[model samples]
Target: MSAPVVKGWCPGAHRPMMSGDGLVVRVRPRMARLTAEQVLGLCDAAQRHGNGRLDLTNRANLQLRGVSEQTHRQLLDDLANLDLLDPEPGLESRRNILVQPFYEHGDQTCRLTEILLDRLADLPELPAKFGFAIDTGSNRVLSENSADIRLETGMSGGLILRADGSQTGVCVSEERAIDAALGMARWFARHSSPELRRMRNLVRHTSLPGHWTGKPPGPLATRSEPGFTPKGPLVGAAFGQILALALDDLIRKSGARALRITPWRQILLEGGHSTPAPGFVTRPDDPLLTADACSGAPICPQAQAETQMIARQMAGRIGGSLHVSGCTKGCARQTAASVTLVGRNGRFDLVKRGRAGDEPAMRGLTPEDLLTLTDLT
Candidate 1:
């Protein structure tokens, strides 16, 4: 059978997407922190009903792969029992809020996140992928992330509600932040057609409020590193894929107080405690960190080539960032990479300094042929 195609919206726990795998069910943990029991429960559920592995998404969500249609109902029930499922099916798509993972309890980010969650119902119905970034950290941490709405710290250290792709933002008090955010959403909803789903798209055609102006926030302060940092212990998952059994074991051994997922192919273990786990990237310069890969071939029927295997082989040898995509869809990394290898008909097409969909510099190169090219240096 061919792989099922997914368009427009993202997959959720209640609404799954079909892939080469039987079914892909996503889990969005409220606040990005999962208890040890919840973590273990998720692993057990994935192993029992789906593929034994879990995919950590760029949105900090978890995806269970290879779930059979027959077992999907049971799996949803299991997830609900674990307090992992959204109460209302509609709420699942609307609760696309991402909180900074390093936030402390009762911090501004946490407070704002709660407010946003509570106000989700008041907002106009948005596209499933439309999201908010509650990035009120000490420094902007999610500037590079995907979000239509952003709650960021302004120059005055006061909160600002900024629409993505807009340099300006409206200053708002902590109390009114959610209201302003919702107002912006309503504005966008009123003006947007189906094609204009995101704030960036709406801004192209419609004018924003005059009040939405302030100094733009800076870029991400620093990229998170593996192992223990003051914020937490960062553990890397090669190609952003982790086996449920292995992760369960790691959690058992690490003794972390809590766990938070990151978009950067790593997991942050809160509390000062963490033990090095096998198959995890511990060092900063681990070559795998520079490579973005997707599950290809047998796992994804759309894939004509194996992606992770090729990425693993190219890790230490290749310099700079690389993306090994199963096809032109470029699911692994949305942005253009320094070098991209797009698979076609069991061979690779090289796209230099562009995304997978970009015109290829060369085509039909096997992994061995690709490695032998002197131009790679």
Candidate 2:
């Protein structure tokens, strides 16, 4: 099979990306959330305008796949009415921000994100995937998530503007936080080229200023698990793929006031009651929660093997973290896993405690071989 191409840019509602299935239209929820009505409406739109399934991206965005050209315009109108679409493509492209799900309304995270949204237009040219994290919560919850520029809390209890690869950050107050982030963005714009598109890549050779490299960040918060949270039930979508009908049913049955998207393959149903949904992972220990796989085979042209079924079979029986990628691109997960199965020539190559593209210990293993063998490590 041909290797998957890594598109430098991500899909936006205004600028959709074409995939094997159809158009991949992404929706960036304002503050990583959607009202109950908005959630229902999006579900309806997904059913009508695209494939009946929606994908929850690692960047805390929602995507509708399998969209046709004829329905694309109507889908945009639906998204606009829901207040999910930005006015123009440039605005949508620039607004790549991730917020911790636990932030309350009008809190530091909220305020900072609002300011950042307003100032997005003022920032210099950036890579298509260039992003920011307003992780100004009690602890740095977004530490595992991807972002070029981060506004996180310092160990000394203040905001710090940290580049992606920096060990430390310069502390700034609430008022000046966005300005500091913008300055760093301009720095990145100047230093980065087409090939060196990400901040982490640039920082490997170029050093951050002394001012932005002294203060350490605060301890990271524990990752949210699939279970009932004070806010609501945190449910996991297997492979970040949710059937629109099941989601619609879930919202209605759980009586959730709203839906909060997370970078993890989980959703926070704000004020939702605990209920066992058919397709959702409700228990914290559910094996599907830990299994990361991308849409493979016909859905994605680059896949050499069908990933979802084999991943489902391997989830519980495996010893540690598992990633079953369709190809080397590893879209479902960025980090290495204890057992990674990379698809090659309609078979599998196993990488233990390494990424998908890493060298495999075993090659040319069929699905039967993986299921029958005992040890993954």
Candidate 3:
């Protein structure tokens, strides 16, 4: 494990740092139509050259861990050979575009992703965290609208970008549609403060001018096709090492390698053309997705029990998004989940929020007795 660097407001600071001589590798395996075999090779490289661990980021990007002071150049050379390295320098961080992997190519949503990435790469001041999302004509993709910029298809045949409940211009042609989105992002970047990390923050101090307002085609909606829902199951890894190994095996067996590393401390592998083995998990209701724990004990000085070990034991019995933390730092997930088990010494405190079928409550319950009182089973 490496020492964590304390950073200020920049998005790059939030990501693991590389030395001046170190390389930041990007892989585009050309499997846009599906997840492919390159994912296995990438995982193997992480184990050998960089850190033995790999981070699955919230943006659906992967990070190789622990590149020593040496081997930096060799890593870059290897990644370039694999066509995984992005040609654009310093622009890699700005290309925070999210696309629905479940959708087919040539759709408006897919087109928007490509356009946004290209436009953003040309702008130097675009915040590293600045992101764009294309919801592939589906309800599941709409939840990803938390992105800085979001594009959705309207009930009519047009598309619109929504910012803070207001609709922007509607585009008849896919080219003009993406151009308008890029204009919006460029405008926001010019007016926002350096301290404003996301569009939501920029919108707080600024309002959408009349020049930017236009008629939205209509309410954006997605129609689900059979088996179009993101089918891969999210699984927790004890640490990045375990994650790398499991990822390697999955990629090797399925030849479907595209992966999404969620900020929630879980990895999502698109099933591609092949279905996983019978025992393989791929549903939201799976026990693995139900529980999460931080690196604790000896690995982290402030930790209590090996949270992952305890959480795995209790996974089947618990339901909802359950998290076990060594301390209050909450390095696991961004938001407080449905259930949280915070550790103190060797004892545990269970907290519950929201009803089974309702939106989870913002407040969390903290009581020792609740652990035995509730019928989580």
Best by lDDT: 2
lDDT of each: 0.86, 0.92, 0.54
For candidate 1, what is the lDDT?
0.86
Residue-pair clashes per candidate: 0, 0, 6
Clashing pairs in 1: none
lDDT of 3 by residue, 21-128 (tens): 243333332222224445666676777776556654455556565565466567666666666665555665566666655555576666667666566555647755
State how far residue 61 of model 2 sits from its true place (Å): 0.4
Per-candidate alpha-carbon RMSD to the true structure: 2.0, 1.0, 6.4
Alpha carbon lDDT of residue 47, candidate 1?
97
What TM-score does candidate 3 get on C-alpha atoms?
Answer: 0.70
Which candidate number would show the highest TM-score if scored against the true structure? 2
Estimated TM-score for each candidate: 0.95, 0.98, 0.70
lDDT: the better of candidates 1 and 3: 1
**Model 1, span 174-275: residue lDDT tens:** 988888888888888888898888898888788788788665664556888787877667889988899999888888887866779987888987763667
lDDT of 2 at 5: 87
Error of 2 at 214 (Å): 0.4
* Candidates arranged by lDDT, highest first: 2, 1, 3
**C-alpha-based local distance difference test score of model 2:** 0.92
